[model samples]
Target: MQQPQDQTTTLQKTFRIILGVFMIAAAVGHLSFQRSEFQAQVPNWSPLSKDLTVILSGIVEAALGLGMVFWKKQRIKVGIALAIFYVLIFPGNIAQYLNHTNAFGLDTDAKRLARLFFQPVLILWAIWSTGALSHLTKKFKG
Candidate 1:
């Protein structure tokens, strides 16, 4: 019989798998039909041209999504990469929230405000699912 700790570990693993899949889908969905929309949502300070940004972001997001599926080491690398990407894109999310930039049918001001909160949650979810929190805990505990 599995111990309680072992059960928890299994639960955590399951959560991670689900979270990874969701993040991957989000990343891919951003790249799919919404590519142009994502470009328009970008803040002015971003480096890529509108079209290039769309294409490149799509590529990166898709790759990051796929990274969650590889071997353990690769998953860790991908998680770190994705965390960086999440940080980088934060401004764009803010721009959308502040400027009321409409895309992907998020027209309501309330919806935009809600989205401001939601993106960060997704980032946190990704971080937790990637086992980064555990690593941090271990580092701090030791």
Candidate 2:
């Protein structure tokens, strides 16, 4: 018979897996729909070529999102990767919000503004699933 705590752990893991897959699908769809828009949004002075940057960002996001399903032992690493990805894309989100730019038919300032708030939730969700609780426990262990 399974203990209550064990059941909870299983549920958490299942939720994480589902969430990870959803994230990967969203990123893939974004790449398909807005690759060119993302490339144009890249700042010219940035070190990477726009094409390379957009493609690499898509690849990294897809990999990290998928990696969450199989990289249980390295959840912390995945969390870090996801957090960094969010930070890197923050500027583009901000630009969209500021300029009210309509790319790929996302022609709404409110939606872009909402994206600024929505992305942080993903960052938090990734951290929470990956190891935020464990990290907090360690801090309080002293």
Candidate 3:
């Protein structure tokens, strides 16, 4: 009996939950066995040590992942924050490509460059999966 829009919203929420689980898994990688691989993605010029950057970002990702899963009333806000986090970390991806650092099996120039293009997709995924894009559009149109 759900309206079309309601069905779409339900799908979006489902996608957001999946994305949340994905984020949590990735955060575990950042903090555990895959830590060194993640360190290669940290920019060489970062003021913080690579390990610290990895650890801090891992913590943030875990928090954001949890928020996406449980903060229904604030999902739009969580989505926006997750999108911003994707944006903020993009420079590290860029640096990895530019420096030719090998990590996460992105061992070739082509692979690294291709990976660079996924950052925007992650940003969009975060926003879209939580209906934040629609919510923001309506807010701005008002």
Candidate 4:
């Protein structure tokens, strides 16, 4: 459980920064070194070319990363956006598993299947770190 106070605790603040940095690093990978590997995760049904889809997601990741780190006033929104982003990209993860596409050291179906379970953790991390989970919970509570 996380503290639902208006201000985030030091732990949440630290984790948010860490997640931000991780996203930035992933963005770099998407744009440069891991371009081909990332293409492996792009679903075949996507309307955009794989390279273009990877590029767009890279841009989005970078923007969200920067927002998470520097946009304190808007982090709740950023966290929400990032959570949504994770949801949007989930199909790519599914495609990786279902298509038996090998990339990012997840060569086996078991590896890929395990990776799918981590997405929700990332989503929860985003929401919890930014207090969005509590905020959202409150919005729906009577």
Pick by TM-score: which candidate is best?
4
Checking candidate 3 for backbone clashes, the offending pairs are none
Pick the lDDT winner.
4
Reference-based lDDT, each prediction:
0.67, 0.70, 0.88, 0.93
Tell me the alpha-carbon RMSD of every candidate. 5.0, 4.9, 4.0, 3.3
lDDT per residue as tens, model 4, 13-129? 999999999999999999999999999999999999999999999999999999889988888889999999999999999999999999999999999999999999999999999
* Candidate 3: segments with Cα more than 4 A from true spot: 1-8
Model 1 TM-score (2 dp): 0.78
Against the hidden true structure, what lDDT does model 2 obtain?
0.70
Q: What's the candidate order when arranged by decreasing lDDT?
A: 4, 3, 2, 1
Candidate 2, pairs of clashing residues: none
Tens-place lDDT digits, model 3, residues 20-100: 998899999999999999999999999999999999999999999998888877777788999999999999999999999
- Evaluated at residue 40, the lDDT of candidate 4 is 99
After superposition, the stretches of candidate 1 with alpha carbons farther than 4 Å from their true spots are 1-8, 27-32
Q: After superposing candidate 4 on the true structure, give the runs of residues whose Cα lies further than 4 Å from its correct spot.
A: 1-6
Compared with the true structure, what per-residue lDDT tens digits does model 2 show for residues 19-108? 679768756855787678877556656688877877778787788878778777666667667777788888877877777777656578
- Pick the winner on TM-score between candidates 2 and 3: 3
How many backbone overlaps does candidate 3 show? 0
